[model samples]
Target: DAGITQSPRYKITETGRQVTLMCHQTWSHSYMFWYRQDLGHGLRLIYYSAAADITDKGEVPDGYVVSRSKTENFPLTLESATRSQTSVYFCASSIVISYNEQFFGPGTRLTVL
Candidate 1:
């Protein structure tokens, strides 16, 4: 089965810099989600797309952007990444949110320097 994974397990970036985090899945699930894990955030959704060219903003959509032009790949870009954005980013996919199990990628640790 095709699984999901991420790159640059660790990242050190400064404020006001452009950083792109990559997410790739093999299952070809219809639903893909981007979430940032923080102390109090408890995995707040950044963005989610049901299909290609159809994306909707999630809980905390500010300071980040997502694009899912394809079914197997979704990338997140932080325009002018900020210190507050320093957190572990996780990408997950599932066939359905209500019953299907959500597969989470290894995750990308981004730090603002």
Candidate 2:
């Protein structure tokens, strides 16, 4: 997609299972990000990739992993899903590192049983 696309728009999984959420964009944007919104409230950054193979931890990255093998794709994985990990995961892209208007995907709502 030219803008952004996320898989599993809605999901339900049991606790301790490994789940990977995919995000892809065609803009070749410089920055990509993953955030989780709980109860449709605050969006907390989980991980971000500046470019291919260049990723860093964000505010809530303990249970998440992200990788960018190409400039247009960034995927987020949860090593072991926990109850607290259930939330609406959003993928965003930006042209810069600063406060540029971030473009967000529809989002993936994950539930932990």
Candidate 3:
């Protein structure tokens, strides 16, 4: 059984373009998160959802958007892709909000030129 997965393991987009990263998990976890990892900034949360249709902004959410319509899938979209947004993106899921281990997917490396 596949635990978690991400689409387009690598992507390249030009500035001003729109890009969407897809994430899916076999487990029906209640909490899902989107994070971006960069050289200087480390891993920063972009957005997260507690349950289906219940979403909230995270630490850095300026250029990114996320939606969770189903328990197994969460997708992140870049409204207007920018060079500054180039980073490795990861998707994670947890059974609960606290005191639970999160299972992460293979990251998607996005390069905005």
Q: Give a tens-digit lDDT track for model 3, residues 47-111.
A: 99999999999999998888898999999999899999999999999999899999999999999
Best by TM-score: 3
The Cα error of candidate 1 at residue 22, in Å, is 0.3
Model 3 TM-score (2 dp): 0.97
Q: Taking the tens digit of each residue's C-alpha lDDT, what string does model 2 give over 1-113? A: 36899998999999999999999988889999999998656999999988899999999999888888899899999989999998999999999989788999999999999
**Displacement of the residue 8 alpha carbon in candidate 2, Å:** 1.0
Off by over 4 Å in 2: none
TM-score, each model?
0.94, 0.94, 0.97
- Which residue pairs collide in model 2, if any? none
Report the C-alpha lDDT of model 1 over 1-113, residue by residue, as the tens digit. 55998887999999899999999999889999999999976999999989888899999999888898899999999999999999999999998667888899999999997
Residue pairs of candidate 1 with colliding backbone atoms: none
| Cα-based lDDT for every prediction | 0.92, 0.92, 0.95
In model 3, what lDDT does residue 75 have?
Answer: 98
RMSD to the true structure for each prediction, in A, is: 1.1, 1.3, 0.7
Residue 92 in candidate 2, Cα distance off native in Å: 0.1
